[model samples]
Target: MSTSSFALRLMDVHVSLAGHEVLHGIDLSLTAGRWSSIVGPNGAGKSTLLKAMAGLLPVTGSIFLFDQTLMAMDRKQRAQQLSWLGQNESASDDLRVWDVVMLGRMPHQDWLAAPSAKDHAVVETALQATGAWDWRERSLGQLSGGECQRVLLARAMAVQAQVMLMDEPLANLDPPHQVDWLEQVRCLTSQNTTVVSVLHEVGMALHADDLVVMQAGRVVHQGPCADAVTHRAVEAVFGKRIAIHALDGQWVAVPKF
Candidate 1:
């Protein structure tokens, strides 16, 4: 594939946390305009790998965003090209939901200048997309866990970045909201936005365009989600305790028991 066709690329990437390596020689290439879900059992280094891709952590090897070196980009340039939604993100409890989402536009704003009209429009659109617009005026402290997650999702969406990397984005969502999130992802991919997520829900991960399976800090498999080889790798990484099957023309994972 052409290098220009990749939204993100990593070469022999390695990350260490607290003096111990967590991600081992991760070489990944994420196609532009595709949704790629990363999956593995606990301690698989999924989050660490994601952080490295986002340039949030120090790494030993090369990472490229589009055709540019990730580390070489300035903070504002990186922010404009990539967005991140992390697990249990912390924002001030006193901040209104609208204000929180507006933070996403900072990278595009002039320092010390008020938000532009376009920023307001983008924030509103993101809030509506995540079903959080109704509570725009409410403070973060007033929302429940699931509600908070939606607001944070809106914040990430408001960035309108070319690439979005999310870690456990469905953390507190209900089944219906999870489906909604899936639809939102489809919409993003349709717009040619590259999405990478670390999903604990095997069934949900199967809905992605591609799957990256990791084991003990190493990537064991990467392929199209519908490929039987990908399913086998997923099951194998989980010790064959789960099985992937087709139901209603969609792949679903069920416990072996």
Candidate 2:
């Protein structure tokens, strides 16, 4: 593959959490400027895998970001290379939405320095992109769950990093907002921003450029979304006693009672 087509490479990455092993020798290469989704049932290590890619967890193997070892870089340096949004992200209720979004600029900002005009511009653009601009002046506590989630997403997008790892971004979003997020992901991909997210929505995950199907602590399948064999692998990973079909152009995973 071309250099531009390969963004991050994970070689035998294994991670443990809370005294339990979660990821088991995971190996995958994520393409740059593309959208990749990881899907699995509970206890499948989906979040753990994402965190390992972001260097948030203690991993045994090497994770390379654009041909450079992520672990070899210092914390500040890695922060400039990768942006992350965890599943249970929480913001102080008293912080203004604008300020929270501006925090994304921290990696590029000097210690104790004030926000620059360019930073303000990026924050505004990110807010508008996530449809959270109207709530910019509001406090975090004033917004609902979905609204808060959008504001946090805007914060991550404002960072403008080349690679972004988000865990459960669709958590509090409604159906319309979920569609909006898909559009945003497409826009980011076009601009050469690689995006990888862990999702519980099977049908939505099927729409990604590539799918990583994890089961237990291992990645059972990783391939293009259009591969019919991959679809069967996905169904097998979930082990759902149901039919998987295409409904109105969207992949639907329906279960039978």
Candidate 3:
């Protein structure tokens, strides 16, 4: 298939942090309108991979967004195509939830452009989608970690980007919120948005449309999420402490003992 057909494509991608290599020579092509999960142990470069894909980390590889080379696109153009939720994102504590959500509209606006009716509608819809509508008037400092995370997710959704890249998005979420998070991802895919996320929850990651198993700075496997071969790859990448099982028509990884 042509590279342009892939929603997000990478060629020989490499990333380093604090003078140490985190990702090495990774090549991946995420299909359009699919939900993909990046799973790995601590320091395995799952987050690094996502950051590289979002153009957050300076890396030494070719990244293409549909038919355009990522680096060639201007900042505004790239921001319009890719929306990102970074790990442990923190905003101004003084801003209200609604104000924070409005930040997502910046990419679509000119300098000093005021929020339009369309922007307000999009923000409202995103807040409802993330269950943060009720907290729209609340100050960011007053919210619990989970609530703030939801608000941030709503902001990302408000960007209305074709590709969403999230790093450890479920970090502050509860069990119910985690389930809702997965459903939000599915909903994005259904709307033809592509998503890639770094997740610590193996079981949740297994539910994605495709899986990328990373280990020691390399992509050990990438394929259909339900394939037995991919299951084996997950087991191998994570070691025997994790076991893969089918539950409710979805694959999950759990402890063996």
Q: TM-score for all predictions?
A: 0.99, 0.96, 0.97
Best by lDDT: 1
Native-referenced Cα lDDT, model 1: 0.96
| lDDT scores of the candidates, listed in order | 0.96, 0.89, 0.91
lDDT of 2 by residue, 89-135 (tens): 98999999999999999998999999999999999999999999999
User: How do the residues 73-132 of candidate 1 rate in per-residue lDDT, one tens digit apiece?
Assistant: 999999999999998897999999999999999999998999999999999999999999
Error of 3 at 11 (Å): 0.7
**Tens digits of per-residue lDDT for model 3, 72-133:** 89999999999999999989999999999999989998899899999999999999999999
Ranking by lDDT: 1, 3, 2
Which ranges of candidate 3 are over 4 A from the true structure? none
Alpha carbon deviation, residue 117, candidate 2 (Å): 1.0
